[model samples]
Target chain A: MNLMMLLEMASQGFADRGAVQNGDQRLSYAELFSAAGGAAGIAREAGVEKLAVLDVSSLAVPVGLFGAAWSGKPFVPLNYRLTDAELESLASQIAPSLLVTSRDRVGSLSKLPDTQVMERDEFLERALGAETPTADWSMDPDEIAILLFTSGTTGAPKAAVLRHKHLVAYILGSVEFAGAAEEDAALVSVPPYHVAGMSAICSSVYAGRRIVQLPSFDPDEWLRLAREEGVSNAFVVPTMLSRIVDSIGEGAEAGLPGLRAVSYGGGKMPLPVIARAMRAFPDTNFTNAYGLTETSSTITVLGPEDHRVAAASDDEAVRRRLTSVGQALPTVEIEIRDENGAKLGPGERGEIYVRGEQVSGEYLGRGSSVLNDGFFPTRDAGSMDAEGYLFIEGRADDVIVRGGENMSPGEIEDVLLEHPAVADAGVVGVPDEEWGEAVAAAVVLKDGQDASSQDLQVWVRERLRSSRTPQRIEFRGELPYNETGKLLRRVLRTELAS
Target chain B: MGQLKAGSRLRSAVCDTEVMVVAAPAAEVELSCGGAAMLEIAAARSGDGAPAPDAAEGTQLGKRYVNEAGDLEILCTKPGQGSLGVAGALLTVKEAKPLPASD
Candidate 1:
């Protein structure tokens, strides 16, 4: 019913096993248990209702995570890559909070009201040194456990609220307790703010797998850590996998010796990239996990055998399973439904709707997104074959998610419109090998006005972050629009691609 | 005893075995361990009685026990010398999970 229960059980099952490690700093299961108790005590005495970590992945990530659960306060992991102003805006939303962050960010972040900023090193030191409280964490399933800020296709970000029961169900349904051997280590290279990072901690803890943290992901460094740590499990995004394949050669000597499993999601994995990777590391098992932030972590997974069978089969139907996300979990039910809220049969592409105990389709202020029929509309377009294999097409909406981060097209276009020489603009996601998709825009110039693509790119880069800046900008007479005045993004995408 | 919801946690009164309800039947049924009624996890365990001959099959850690009707499923978090039972029938462990951990 609680995240602490997973840690408690792991501590009892294997007290001496390593729970977390970061550069010669390690905590055994018993040590992590005690440190979580200490973290709870610190938060309780500080009188904060929530514990938010603004720093990168480190030992404090797990401590703050389990510690907040023990303290009965929601743990909030903020994205550290945001600008200072954006970071403060989100900090204000979760005010009256204990903010764990780096040293340089403390002064400006502490200026906010009711926000107590503790440096990362100091926070870890105090959390590790405080008096350990007894294991008396609340078992109420409805208690809020984590608050992850996800930017929808809207103005501001919404806090995706994950309750204890939602996460517990996901873990218990998918992961077996203490199923990992003592020597099994999981390489956690994703950012702590990501959904994958949060779920990795819970799954690894319950499985009694050692966690090796990597704050910044580099292909060489990742492989080095994996080789040195004897890592058996790993999860990466498609962009990371492609780059990792690009770094190493295709031979046994280049393979990660002990890596048994490698799972990827967050973007489509090209067949050539994975094919090259499988040849590079012949012993590794590749899985493609597909899920949304609202549905906990992974609701459907293409297992290892499916990858092999799909790659080896000459039949097109069986080989197409390589791109499918496979079937739903044993405890989950998935359906494809049209816009009329009616269910569609197999081989029909519609919005992906899922129903399960693990799906927490609720935001902080907004009401539950789950429909009356108990199905949560995933807002993703996908179809399933007759055998229940799910294939993802793309986002149902026009939200441009580049490199796993959501970028608002309207916001970018609005900035381009601010240019005095620009009359109108339309932004859409174009296919790219890395980052899954790149931001591209088509623009129409004002009468008797002259401006180059470089001029507009700099204008937007100053207004927005570089990541949101359009990679490709094309000048045309006008952008395509329908009779109802809705921008025809699909037509623009095809026009730009050709 | 609390309602047998999916996330409900229960413990065997005669042994250290603990389980969480995964799939519950529509109707409340007698769920027992070691021939004795399983108590809520918060309840104190006596650890005095031995497993009956018919229910002596020990439970395994990280295994799912299900009844014949497939309406009730429980996951064992801790192992002990107690067999899971529902309505006087011994539960069987589900063997060979079809999928591996995705994360």
Candidate 2:
């Protein structure tokens, strides 16, 4: 039941296979197992309530994660990008913890009370050098495995709790044990604090896939590593992919022939970006994975076949699926529900609700948010088509209500993106005296291309109803996006409203 | 015999095979391995005897076995020289339909 069990099985199944790699440093399954045991011994001797990592992806990540599980403590990864004050506030929340961070951050982070700080190199040295403890991890499925802080783009971050059972069910249901080829390697560039990063480590371990870590994301460096390491699989946020596509240049080969599959999520991907990416990596299979931190990673995936079919089809409905998130996972059931909690039929816009063994909608202090029927309200606005394809509009709170009519920003933004000159777009509801609210848009044009605001408005009016057209359109150099590729819609709303 | 529930781990009494229940019918059913009743993972082993010749089909690690009715399924956690069965009928390996790797 413990996370250690997955590692144990992998170590036993393939003792000599490389489990993780960072630069030139590599660790086999057996080596990682003993190191985790060694790190667990340190956590136990330190008597911390939890083990926290405050650095980017590195060798210490897996050791810290599995070590925490072996010691029967929750593992917490803090955002290294946070400011000192913000970092201190979060560090204080998880007091009496073993904090692992870089050498430069040790002095400042060590000031917290009831905390023991160790640099990453020292931590790894001690973990690898210490005596290994006999496998004594508890098999309690209900034990807290990880405490992840939500990105909280709209408000303060809250800790989302993931139990061992929730994660194990997710892995066992989605992945086949030892199903990977002997030479398969997965490239992971997401920070350690993100849910995708943690799940990548766990899934790669159980699948017997070698993990290649990128300390920080750079398009040239990513391309270099993929070429040098023979990486066959990878995961990226929309921003990273967009940059990689741009870096590859137009009509030029990406030069990464070894890559077989690439999955992107964490934000809504613009249609143009994905279409261009497909052309850049002609042989790569693209998957759009959609999930939240509370869902333990991806709940729905647009598979490789769907991508190929959608890209080649002339039918508008079929081609549009390239922008959809695809169908729900076989292990999960997805429903679109109206505000009254009643289920909506196909093509009816509503909030997304999910029911599955992997859903843990509970926060640290707030009890389970799962309904009596075992469904978790995802608070994401989306619609399901007749064929079970799910199209995510945006966050439910971002929906615009203009003159008593609810409108999705995603729908309007998609129409705008179809315009040849438009490169990116964001739609928001601005306060109006007569209608109570009016549709407003901010757009970025393609390089060296020009389009007037009135012309863009006409483009939307021609495709969709006049009521859905943007009343106010502002042209900008570029739209704002967070580090993880999520659009800062709240900021746009504020600027446009004023 | 007791009704098998998901997450319950069982081990063969006469061999090294161990399995965890993934799905089971509501009703209690006889579960056996190597022509002998299975024991709970924590329960004491009956003896160190070998599997009966007729039942020694062997089990592989990480493979799932299911009964004919499809109402019972178990995941082999440890490989051993014994085939799982229900009422003298041997179980077959369940083909897995793997979901696409996301993240």
Candidate 3:
């Protein structure tokens, strides 16, 4: 089904409820529906093939999202954080398109070939004024709904194509229609470019939630909005959560007592950070969601109940699950396979392969990456426990191979992070003539705490084997992480090469 | 009266009910609504049959009706006075289990 169908249902399900709020601006479900239609009319009139958004989060985001769907055009949200050259390169890919962007870029972007540039403010005003068209959106399930450019942590970005069916399946399998309470408001701090950001719109609409937009994330502002709006739900990347936890500091009070649930993903959640967050928000249910852009949104989720159980359990295996990404969703099937494509049993580490309706293994320029058997190799190294809990062990290339021995950087990084002085750590394989590669680590020490290279090495050697210990170590003020909290291991590899 | 794949749209000839197949069984099954055969989207609705006894229950918009084996899932996109049935048996509305909101 079309994404517009979700909006259509929401408008009918709860017409008077607030669908979106940004700053002083607000739109009811009915208004958002009509606004989307207005945007669609503009898109249709422009004769554009795609709709692109190059601005921070706002009412314009949802309006543009459903508008693109209503007009049967792919919605492409470019990373606004990119530089002029970078933005121009991406914008050129979807030429002959309507680019809704911030006011400052309109003049420069209008020069791009075959591109129609509309300032975000002007677009909003026009869309608000335009009469909604009468025609309904196309129902072709194979129609492209979203085109997300991958973060390209490894290399150049590739456009990941998500069809209407994949996204609809994800929403249908995961969300319950009109499940959210009338007073429940979701604080959306994530950017519109990310897959999670897009799914947040669809799922919230289907669930009839009042979405409160945060254009850009600020810890104090986030907390203030949560309190002011009585936000019951929120989704933040790991780094955002860490900062929010740090901002709250050590406290007994339930921060934002109205927050009923908090889900964090998009990067590894450090043990210390999540532990502190759980304590800070004692009543909030913590969900650890893990998925890739290729997978509509979340393929597996560590539910809130799992967090409480794992934390309070006496069993070591059960307690370790607090760090795991949890089990696969009912509609998803996950398997860990070796390099030869052989499926591995529980406790055997291998690459993650998944198959389900939500798995969109197709890319824009590149053909489908899905295997003949329908499983998409995730390129993520991980393992599953007997109980089906999945543990993500960094990306496949992130695995350190020293002298042909496969080692997980996450395993070594865990031991180093356990050191009381270590605040952050990244382990990589540095080139070594004798062993082909050797273990090297970059660590950030907590303020007011000190630990020598040898001290931390011994700590890892004691916990793990000597071979797993870092051969070289360097201390830094902090590790490099993207806005989304993924550690730039490629950057670490280059820095440690010297 | 044949294989129904997910994403296929169907409509009832006797009512305004339109549904998209969310899931379908591997074996052949006759999928019907309001005791009349469900036709493809392109087929014109005849509106000839009334709601049959023992299957007069109406279909709600956005509700998913599934067979007993839990394989065939039909999501009603339009509310109508037709009850969805499969293989001469009535389909029940599947309970929606709300998952924790995760982006």
Candidate 4:
């Protein structure tokens, strides 16, 4: 089924139920559907064939979102945080017909055509006041629905084109994985531009679950909301999770009475941090999810069950399982391939590849399509266990070349995380003419815990080989990371450079 | 002052609907202020000092300042920063709704 069916089902199942909610504005399924219908009419009047959304994280954004979808045009949401040059590049690429935004935020764009600009209030006014569209708006399964650009944190962003089927698979698969029910309540804070944020919204809606929306990520407020709203499910980066765990100290149980599960991603969750979370709230099912903007939210998820089982058993088996990203999602097909594109056997280290309805075939820009025999090369170095569980080694771009040996930041970072005092860790290769590249680490100590740079260095050296151990360690309050929680190793490298 | 328009042609790429009044300086300003503070922009209406035609509907100018963070539709008015005694008006538009679902 397509995304339209999801909306139609929600409209039919829970017409009077609170469908979309913000602070003062809450719209029921019927109201939202009708409002979007009204927006579809406005889009038609504006002659918008391919609508480009400028601002997404707004209350009115959903209206434009549905309206554009109903008009059967792929909705491209640009990253509002990109540089002007980056934005111009993206704008040039899309060459959209209409620019959709709010009246109050209309003065910002540096460059654009003299295209019709639909402000939020004006669009809503016209949508609510005007007649709904009469055109028979429809979409095929293969038709692109939403186009999301990469974070571009490393370099120029590549747009990932998500079709209706991909979104459907993501929502359905996530809902099944979470085992969410109508009684479940989700607290969503991730940005809508990201796949995680989008999937969270869809899964909650499809499951007929209530969602408590947070405009942004705030540690204290997030915990407060979880406790106050009786929030059952939520998504957070590992860093955010660590902050929440710290806020809720040892003695007093942080009043998360209703919170049953919390999904953590954007980076690896250190074993100690996972243990801390487990100790603090044994009741909360903390899940580890792994995905990029390229493949919806998560193609693989390590559920709470795995965490408990792994933590309970002291054997390497559990730690090894926990280290990996766990088995692929039921809907996704996973493969491990060598440099030459030949598939590797189980228990071999190679590039992780995913092929499924959830996987996109081509990027929107200069990059080639992933339709190489229908597998998207994740560019992440990984290995599959004999049991078929996937373990991410590191990103292909993140691999550091030493004199002759290759070093993966993931390997060093994982080792550093083993230290009890280390809360979060990131390893990057620093330029060194002698060795060509040297491994360096940036680590954040646990709250109220102190570990010097030498202490961390010795700690890593003890566990790993002399060559694999980080040559230098930098102590910091926290490592720089993107909104998704992925460590910005390049930042650490820049710091070392300076 | 010349009667030139203050607002430029806004593309979706440059705008954020959550935070109503956007003042993107030609250069990046190092904002030292943390947390949410009342942001005041010397906002000039499009084309002329007069607000948009829709803004004249007895709609409070404050309602024009939509804080996407709290999703609060407040009545924002032009006031001196000294009056508020706030350091800077750096509104953080962090998270937003999910991208639109397709077909």
Of the true interface contacts, each candidate retains a share of 0.50, 0.46, 0.60, 0.00
TM-score of each: 0.82, 0.97, 0.97, 0.77
| Model 3 alpha-carbon drift over 4 Å, by segment | A252-254, B1-3, B14-16, B26-30, B39-50
In model 2, which runs have C-alpha deviations exceeding 4 angstroms?
B44-47
Cα deviation at A248, candidate 3, in Å, is 0.7
Q: What is the DockQ of candidate 4?
A: 0.01
A1-498, model 4: which lDDT tens digit per residue? 245445555666566766666666676766767777787777677775666666645556566666767777777766656655666677666665566664644665534653456676676677667665553456356667778887765876778888776776666444531234555677877766777767766676666666677776777888877777678888877777777777877544665757788787777776666677777776777777788777877888777777778777888866678776677777688998887889899877678888876787568755546765888988888888787777887687788888888767887888877787877788888888799988877788877888888887788778877887787887788788886667777778899655
What are the clash counts of all predictions, listed in order? 0, 0, 0, 6
Least accurate stretch of 10 residues (summed lDDT) in model 4 chain B? B9-18
**Candidate 1 falls in which docking quality class?**
medium
lDDT of each: 0.85, 0.91, 0.90, 0.64
| Candidate 2 reference-contact recovery | 0.46
lDDT, candidate 2, A142-246, per-residue tens: 899999998877998788999988888888888888988999999999998999999999999999999999999999999999999999999999999989999
Best by DockQ: 3
TM-score of chain B of 1: 0.90
DockQ of each: 0.58, 0.64, 0.65, 0.01
Cα error of candidate 3 at position B7, Å: 1.6
CAPRI quality band, candidate 4: incorrect
Q: What is the interface RMSD of each candidate, in Å?
A: 2.0, 1.2, 1.3, 16.1
Arrange candidates by TM-score, highest first: which order?
2, 3, 1, 4
Per-residue lDDT of B14-95 in model 3, one digit per residue for the tens?
8888888999988887888888888997789865687676667889878999999999999887777879998789999999
